[model samples]
Target: MQAQPEKKHSSTCDSKEDSNKLESRYQFCGNALRITRDFSNNLGISAIIWESGLVLCRYFEQEKISFSGKKVIELGSGTGIVGILAILLGGDVTLTDQPVVLNQIEFNVTSNIPVSIIQRSKVSDLRWGKNEDQFPTDYDFILGSDIVYSPHDFPSLIKTLQHLSNQNTIIYISSKMRETMGAIDFHEKLLPQHFNSELVHRNEEKEINVYKVTKKAREQPSA
Candidate 1:
C-alpha cells in the first residue's frame, strides 16, 4: 500500500513494528470471488478477500445479513476488498487508510468490482490521532484486516474506533496472528473496551482470527 507521512506531534503515539517482506501472486476463488496480489505493505501480507469478504456478501445476498442498505466504514483496509464487498451489498462505505496507502487501496477496489455494483465509497485518508479533528463521529460499521500489530497504533486506533462508532454500530476486524509477543497481547487488553467481541471465524492452520465487535461506549482517550 502507498503511504502518507505524519508530521511531528501529530502522533506521539506511533510505534514501529518489525518489518517483513512478502512476494506476490493472484489466486482465483469461486465465481464472484477472486484473490490478487496487493503491493501495499510491500506485499508483506496476502490480503485474502474471498471467504472473509465473500461470507459477508453471501449473507447479504441470502438476506441473512444487512449491510447493502447501511452506512459502513473500514479501517486499515489494505486492498479495500471488504469495504467494496459491502458496497456491492449496497452499503455506503468510507474506505480509509493513511493517505499513502489510499491510492493502492483504491486501485484494488476499483479494478475488481463490477460497474453494476453502484454505490458510494470514498478513499479517505486517516492517520489515527494525527488528524483527529477530521474524524467522523458517526458510522454504521467499521471493518479491517490484520490491524492489531503495532502497540503504538493501538491507542490511536482505538481512539478512532470509538470516534467513528455509535450505539447502534458494529466494528469488525480480522487478522492472522503473527509470531510477535506485542501483537498477540494487543487483543488481550483491547478486547475489554468493546462491549461485545467474539471470534466468529478462523483458520487455525493459518493462524488467522476474525472477530466481530459491537456495543461500544464513548471513552475518549487522549491518544
Candidate 2:
C-alpha cells in the first residue's frame, strides 16, 4: 500500500451524501457492515453498492478463500466493502478508486472495522494505469469487483493489472456479465490474453462471475 497522505480531510458529509445518502447493510464474518451510498456525485456510480461486490464476498466465503497474512489490494473499490471484508479476514488490505471516492470508502472502513483490525485497512486513490507504478508490484492478492463494465477502460485496466502483479500474485475479479457494456468480452477475450484466467465461481441467479487469475508464464526463447 502507498503511504497515507498526512493532510487528508476527515469528511463527515458531502452535499451528495447530505441529500441522497443511503445505507446498504450486509452481514459478514459475524458482523454487520453499513456502507454509505451517495447518488449526486459525478462518479455517483461508485458511491452505490453493486451486487457483484456482494457476490464476490459470498464467493470468498463459500470457497474458503484465505486472505490471512497476505498483502492485498482492491481496484475500483466503490463502497469499499470487498476490501473491508478482506481486512476482516486478516489481510493487510488497500482499498482504491478515484480520488473523489476515497472519503466515502474511508468513512465506511472506519465505521465497520474495529479499531484493532482497522489498522490493517488503508484507503488510496488509484487511477488504473496512470500512476500504478507508484505502488508496489508484489502484492499477494489483487481484487476488483464490477470494474470491467466499460470497454473504454479495458486497455488501461489490463495495463494496470499487469503493472501491479508479479508471477505469484493471485488476482480475483468479480463482474456482472453485462454484455451491453462489454464486461463479458473483457473476461472471455481481453483478460486471457495477458493472464491465465479461470472461472472459479459463478452465481447464475445474480449473473456474476468470479475469475481467478495468475500471471501467464513467459515463454522461454529457443536456445
Candidate 3:
C-alpha cells in the first residue's frame, strides 16, 4: 500500500519556535493581524519587520485608502506585513522578494490574512535588476518599505521601480529617515525625469516618512 500523505493544518500563527523568533500583533480598522518572522540574518534583511512598514500600515489605515479592485505589487516584501494590509484594503496584491524570503512571505500571508483575501494575493520571487520581465508592469500601485537601505542597490532599485511603473501608476514608499542610507538620496535621484515625489506623511516618533511617487506629465511640443 502507498504511504498516506501528511495532513495539513492552518492556524492563526506558525509553530512555537517560529513565533518565538519574531512576532507582531497589529490592530487595524477593528481587525487584527499577526505577523511572524522566522529566519536568520543570513537569509537577508527580509527576516525582520522594520519601523517603516509599521508606519506605512498605520498611514494607510488612517487615511482609509480604498484599494478596491486595484492591482498592487510590493517590492522587497519583508515579513509581508504591508502586503497583507493591502489585501485587507481590497487590493489584489503580489508580494515579491528574493527566493529565500518567499517562503516567509507566504507563511505570513496564509496565517494572518483570511482565505478570501488570500485568494486574491500571491507571492513571487523578484530580484531587483534581474528577471524584470517576470514581474508585471501594469500595476496600479507599487509599494516599498525600507527598501533603500543600501546605496549600492539604488541603481537597481530605481530601475525596478521604473520597469514596474507607467503613466498611471502610483508608487508609495515608506522609509525610515535615518541619517545614513535614508530614502532622501533615492528621491533626489528620482525627481523631474522619472516621477514627481511628494512627502505624504511623517512620524517623528517613529522617524518614518511616507512618499507618494507619480509619473511626470509629458510636455506638449510647439507646433
Candidate 4:
C-alpha cells in the first residue's frame, strides 16, 4: 500500500522540537544495537525507534524463538532495530521501508550487526501493496512493528501482508495500542478476517500487543 509521504508524527515521537541526530543503544542477544535517528529529514516517524520494536525484541528473547536459518522480512522497518535483531538471532532478514528511510536503516543494520553476521541482512524500499509482487512469498517469518497507525493505509497493508505470506509463513506484528491509531480495530477486527491472528503477548504497561499470525486456509468449493 502507498502511504502518504513521511511526515511528522507528533503524538508518538519524543517531545523534541528541534531536529537533530539522536543515537540510542540497545542490548539484545548479547549484542549492543546502535541506532541513529535523523530527525533533520522528512523521514518523520520512521526516523525514531519505537517502543513496540523493543517489546517485540523482548518477546523473541522471552519466548526463546529461534530465527536460526529462517528467512525473515520486516515491513516498515524504522531504524531497523527489530530486523537487525532477527539477524543477530540467525535469521536471514530483509528490512523494508520507504525509500527515504532506507539509508538510515542500512546504517543501523551495519552499525549493529557484526560484519560476519551482517551478510544476512539487507534493506529495500516497499510501498506496501503497490510493489509487493517484487518479493517472494516464501518467507518463514514476516516481522513488523508500529506499522499500522493510519487507517488510510490499512487496505494496502493487508494486501501486502497477504502477498508475502504462504500457508506456513508466520507473521509477528508488534503494535502500540492507540485508540486514535486504530490499532485495536486492525488487530482485533480486520486481521482476523484475513488470517488466523493470535495475541501472543500484551504489555499492559506499554499498551502494546504482539500478534502471531498465519494464513487462513482456502475454503473448499462445495458441490
Candidate 5:
C-alpha cells in the first residue's frame, strides 16, 4: 500500500495514438517493468496501477517464488504487472480484465516482456460474473491485485473464482484495506466453506495485505 508517485507524459502508441498518459516503472528481482496507464480515460479504475499490486509483486520477487511451467491466470489484471512477472518466472500466463482494459494489458505485455518470454503470455477479456466459458478451469494459480473493493461486485467475483479453480488450485490476492471495509468483507464471506484463507503478508503502514486462498476439500460420503 505504499503510495505511488505519479509520472505523466504524452505518448503515441498502437491503441490510442497521440494521447496523454501516466507512466511508471517498477523493479523487482533485477527485472524492471515500464507501464503506461490512462487515468483520465473512460476505462475508469482499471487504468491505474495500485499499491497492493506493487506489494504483491515485491513479496513474490523477494521470496523467489517459482512459477516455472505453471499455468496461471490473473483476474482483474490492470496494467498486467503481476502476470508479467509470472511469465518472467517461467509461467504460462493469461492476463485478463474487462474488455475495455484488454488493450492496455496487451500493450504492457508486449512492450515490457522480451520476445523470448513474451511468447509465454496472452491477454484475454474477462468480466467477473460473465464469460465463464471463455477461460480454462484448470489453472494452477489464480492471481488478483487490488480487486476486492466493490461490494456490489463481490458475488460475481467469488463466483468467478469458483468457476476458475479446481480442488488443488491456489489463489493469491492482494488488497488495500481502507475505510470502506469492502475488502475485509470479501475475505470474511470466503471462509471455510469455499476456501481456506490466510494472511500471508501485510504492510501495516500502507494498509495492504496479501492473502493465499486454497479451495476447501469436499466431504467424503459415509458408507
Candidate 6:
C-alpha cells in the first residue's frame, strides 16, 4: 500500500524484453494505447496506457459516476486510467498496482487528464493478501480489470477483498473469460461472499463481462 518510488523500468527498445511480456492489453474501444506485460513476478506487471483506457472511458461516459464523494480504490490498476477517470467524475480515488506499472500509470494520467482530475488521483503499489497496511482504510468501492485468472491466487484474491472492505463496500470486477477454468472457478467461489451478483455489461468481441458485487454483513457493525 506504500507509495514509495521503486526502480524505473527502462522503456527502451529491447525485443527480448518485449517477448517476455505475457500479453499486451488495449483499451476496450480498440485503442492500441495501453499495453500490459506481466513481468517476472507472477503477482506483478507493468502497464503502458497512453491517453487513458477505452474500457474506462466508456464506463464513465455511459453513466455519470455514482461514487461522487466516496473513496474509491482500483486494484491491479495496470495503467491507472480507470481510476483517473473516476476522479474526473468526482470520486476520491486511489490507483494501485505494483511498482513496475506505476511509471506508466504516471505517464497516462498526466497526459490525458486535466490538472484538476489528476490532483484527485493517488498512485501506489499494493500486493494483495500481503503487505497492505499502506492502503486507505474502508474504501467505499473496489475495482479491478482483467485481474483474476490463476487458481493459486484465488485464496489470496478473495482474502484481499475483506482487507480493503468496510461494513459496506461495493466491488466491481471486469474480465474477459478467455477460456480459463481457474478464472471461472474463482468467480463461482467468490459469488457467495457477496450480497448480490449481477451482470453489468458484456463485450462480445472481447468476451469480457462486468459484475457488480455488494458485500453482506452477517451482523451489525460496532459503533
User: Pick by TM-score: which candidate is best?
Assistant: 4
- Expressed as tens digits, the lDDT of each residue in 13-74 for candidate 4 is 23334347787766765666677887777788888788899888878776668899999999
lDDT of 3 at 204: 67
Candidate 2 residue pairs that clash: none
Model 1's alpha-carbon lDDT is: 0.60
Ranking by lDDT, best first? 4, 2, 5, 3, 6, 1
**Comparing candidate 4 with candidate 6, which one achieves the higher TM-score?**
4
Compute each candidate's TM-score over C-alphas.
0.69, 0.89, 0.85, 0.90, 0.87, 0.71
lDDT of 3: 0.79
Q: Judged by TM-score relative to the true structure, which candidate is superior, 1 or 5?
A: 5
Model 4 pairs in collision: 1-128, 1-129
Question: What C-alpha lDDT, on a 0 to 100 scale, does residue 190 get in candidate 6?
Answer: 65
Residue ranges of candidate 3 with Cα displaced over 4 Å: 1-20, 218-223
Error of 1 at 115 (Å): 3.8
List candidate 1 stretches off by more than 4 Å: 1-64, 116-119, 179-181, 217-223
Q: Which is the leading candidate under lDDT?
A: 4
Instruction: Please report, as a residue range, the 10-residue window in candidate 3 with the lowest summed lDDT.
Output: 2-11
Off by over 4 Å in 5: 1-19, 179-181
Better of 3 and 4 by lDDT: 4
Better of 3 and 5 by lDDT: 5
What is candidate 4's CA lDDT for residue 53? 90
Q: Candidate 2, overall lDDT?
A: 0.83
Cα deviation of 162, candidate 3, in Å: 0.9
lDDT of 4 at 223: 88
- Which parts of model 6 are misplaced by more than 4 Å? 1-45, 48-53, 219-223
- Model 5 pairs whose backbones collide: none
